[model samples]
Target: MEINVIEKIENPLLNRTEIHFDCTYQGEATPKVLDVKNRLVATLNVDKNLLVVHNLKPSYGEGKANGYAKLYDSEENLNKIEMDHVVMKNKEATKEEKEEAE
Candidate 1:
């Protein structure tokens, strides 16, 4: 899969960066969110816990998908703005938070 980003925004008040990318995604069962999260982490050299994959989708029959994501300054800020379901879907971060608190 290849990602071509078309938009990027940094919101200081939110303490996050918003990004939109167009991607050629082939794996049907793969969660694009995970891929996007990884890409953003590598690109920004930031912790995965601070990233949120908002949505990634394509129109029916199209292999190319549009994706949106945000990179937060910290896990707390991430939880503050992201939806509950989104936070739950990313089990990795939740587990990390638990380990950190222990």
Candidate 2:
């Protein structure tokens, strides 16, 4: 699977960064991970140490459904797994500081 970051927006109310990305499944006629002409939203909250992601638009077409994955950086390693949300936190950190830390 291949993914690319498309756009991003900072949400002050949520104190998180919302990232939109274009994902493509590179294989032989495999199902897509997301719907076409729709955007996927991933929220990264470092202050709360959480990452929440969801499909902004659900797939309406027939066939296999799209998939989503949550990734995290822990213990100096990157872990990719299935999850609904992710959380992390550290002292002496501001929301702006945390976003820059990413």
- Best-performing candidate as measured by lDDT: 1
lDDT (0-100) at residue 80 of candidate 1? 79
TM-score result, candidate 1: 0.74
On residues 16-95, what C-alpha lDDT tens digit does candidate 1 reach at each position? 88988777767564445777678767866778887777888875666677888787888888887888999766546567
Q: Model 1's lDDT to the true fold? A: 0.76
Poorest 10 consecutive residues by lDDT, candidate 1: 24-33
| Per-residue alpha-carbon lDDT of candidate 2 for residues 1-102, written as tens digits (9 for 90 to 100) | 344666666655444455565455543344333322222322232322233344433334432234333333332222233232332211234799879999
TM-score of each: 0.74, 0.36
Each model's C-alpha lDDT?
0.76, 0.38
lDDT for position 60 in model 2: 46
- TM-score for candidate 2: 0.36
